[model samples]
Target: MENLKDEQQNHHQPVKIDLSGSSFWAKKGLKSLEANGARVDVYWDFRQAKFSNFPEPSSGFYVSLVSQNATILTIGDLKNEALKRTKKNPSATEAALVSKQEHVHGKRVFYTRTAFGGGESRQENEVVIETSLSGPSDPEMWITVDGVPAIRIMNLNWRFRGNEVVTVSDGVSLEIFWDVHDWLFETSGSSSGLFVFKPKAGFESKSLSFNGRYGDGEGEDHDVEDDDSSPKYCHVLYAVKV
Candidate 1:
């Protein structure tokens, strides 16, 4: 797991807890630690965890973080199992996933899964990004959600940096932004594209404007005054063509 934080501050370093295999520590079943000055108890069972190309597991596991007698963060599909093992009620102010940053390596197509909406209505959708950077035809890009083409950009060399709004589900929509200047202009083969997916409900007003860049680079930095009121969901994907 990475950046396990509480309500007050963010933890920079990742905390690795081996929950799989028959190792001595893994058999102990529970691990206790401190993050951001808060006591956190971690409960996990990844013996049957399923994974794809990503390092994170897809399903068949549970990782729960409990603090102050409440389950603050729970990951995986086995939420009930995590709650049963932790013996704690879900926190009233549960920690929300604010943003996810992924570095994906692919030649033409990049695949990822993301959940849209909040609470009981939240649904996970398959996200696929396909680009034709060097072909007989003009360069183009296609972004699909749940097997449906959400956005298609033609003549990508000219329209490399832009944003669009697409509906993902009945009531859920996403404001997608893309910046592929490096992929088209960089002579060095180490080119990557930046794609930002933000929920279209109250996200623009809550979050700062995206400056068409990712990570540490030359850009004007905008600070959010109220951390508590900031948008709680954003997905930033760095697609590196190899």
Candidate 2:
């Protein structure tokens, strides 16, 4: 396993990280949450964030904090070369329009509902800020908001919005939901119920235990194997003081 120092040093490079999509979102979302409370800034590894097991480009979300109530934002590939077409040629059929931009923690988060190909409907990357106001950290969530097969949220105690459901995969399963505004601990059951996440003081710092599912880049297959599985895995994030 690579040391934390090494990981921190080369975080910009596309390293094989085993973080879940929701976790990535949570960490990034903290920027917005923190912004609501204090000064904050956020940065994401665009190059690595675009690397996924599926297709070619990677799709995901990341957040940053700039102030106690201000956040800078950018989604995976939202600012990439792909979206240049939309800026130049704005078309209802060819380009996506802003779905909505609401103020979360004083920052305006812009979400765009876009359709690609013919019936292949999906949400395009959203943007929240221009320049980063904070540094970078490991992702808390990394699932494609609109382009995956499945994700299973075994236990979720938080409230959520967007596409809030799990999609089954051939070999792996993904779960993307917030613990509402709480933390989750010691709960497991069916794949068909609202599993609430309760809060704990140090749950975030408590080392994660993926059981046997995690492999440290020593040659492990952690990519989605099938398409047409589940498309949306949405979760909402809220800040709770420690």
Candidate 3:
């Protein structure tokens, strides 16, 4: 019983992260995006992103359909990325959260049960992107993108070693391999997030990709456009050197 108690205490203990070596995201196309409509582009890869001080804190990305605003969710640790944090204190009566559990560190981790409520009908324009974040059904991480159905995600979880890959498809599949195992298990290094999505099938041909790039000279202004010529600022790139 004493040993079990010790383990439980450790489970709830705050994760001491070397703030200097944290993993977060900043894509490479924000310059062009912000110029276009007060746009806010954020990228976060939860595969390696750490959340401190919460039992089963849902860390991923989230989007508001009404406003078309999107942001990544984490435990509030990032070296170079803008932290969009929202705290929810739901009273049991108004509880939108249900109970589900996962065991990560020998302790059971609880997750929220959520049913992405329905719209009156399908929106004229709809987009979906699978982050493969593997959080509670009540996804805290939601974003805009498009894809048909399921695709084999062998490289995403990578045996729970933190080698993850996120792929999106308009039927034109784009994959983002979050290359990080050292940072996830080692010291406090950082990781990047890639957000990709396309408009609903046939509704629009254009696709969107956000690459959160980091490293040396991480803050220098850079531009990202589609592969085609003409500098048609179709995609937004955001790179943050944390």
Candidate 4:
């Protein structure tokens, strides 16, 4: 009886440790993303440009639909690319996170959870954290960015709740605007509709070949017709530097 009581006590005790070293993300500031998944010889060339933190605690992670009926969700961590991999035989609610930093440079932190049966049994939405951060999911442990709570999730379909106020991991902030509509692509002859985030002023969007296509791919180049008279921008390139 005594051994059982002691074991129960130890299991129930809150596990506390210095989060500064553990999977803790930047509370604020700038972030740089290095491409590590590709060949090291060409990593730098294929490196993604640095991006600014949205300045709030948020779950504003990004996802790319790699193929029909499949999506690749990511937290934007670049140092250890494998840190985002989903473990084998993971449960339906598999929660994993990574946190790292260096004195000379800012840190990259992130976490993700895959719930197989959450979305009406037809579709599934993955939750992600795009910044290096650490903390339990408790209301008392609220996170703040620029003195205000961060905008975490931007579900255009009104699926997720509880994270109503967006939160920035460190210095990242995202503006939320969404519209629902239907469209068709002539290339694949597939019809799909989804939401997209348009980065704030001064931030640029680059196209990345998720699965097929290559550098100088069609639509990668941007041009404005002389009659339209709109500002012409450079083509968004998407080739792995590796």
Whole-model lDDT per candidate: 0.69, 0.26, 0.25, 0.23
RMSD of each: 6.6, 18.8, 20.1, 23.8
Off by over 4 Å in 1: 1-43, 48-60, 64-92, 202-231
Runs in model 2 with CA error above 4 Å? 1-38, 41-74, 80-169, 173-193, 196-242
Q: How good is model 1 by TM-score?
A: 0.63
lDDT head-to-head 2 vs 4, winner: 2
lDDT of candidate 3 vs native?
Answer: 0.25
Question: What does candidate 3's lDDT look like per residue over 121-230, in tens digits?
Answer: 21222333233343543212223333334233343435221111233332322322222232223335433332222112122233222244332224532222234322
Best candidate according to TM-score = 1
TM-score rank order = 1, 3, 2, 4
lDDT of 2 at 186: 19
How far residue 14's Cα lies from its native spot in candidate 3, in Å, is 44
Task: Give the per-residue lDDT of model 4 (tens digit) for 91-194.
Answer: 11211221111111112212222211112121212222232122443112122333355444333224211212132343332222211111211234322222
TM per candidate? 0.63, 0.17, 0.22, 0.17
When 3 and 4 are scored with TM-score, the better candidate is: 3
lDDT of 2 at 147: 45
Better of 1 and 4 by TM-score: 1
Better structure of 3 and 4 per lDDT: 3
- Which of candidates 2 and 3 reaches a greater lDDT? 2
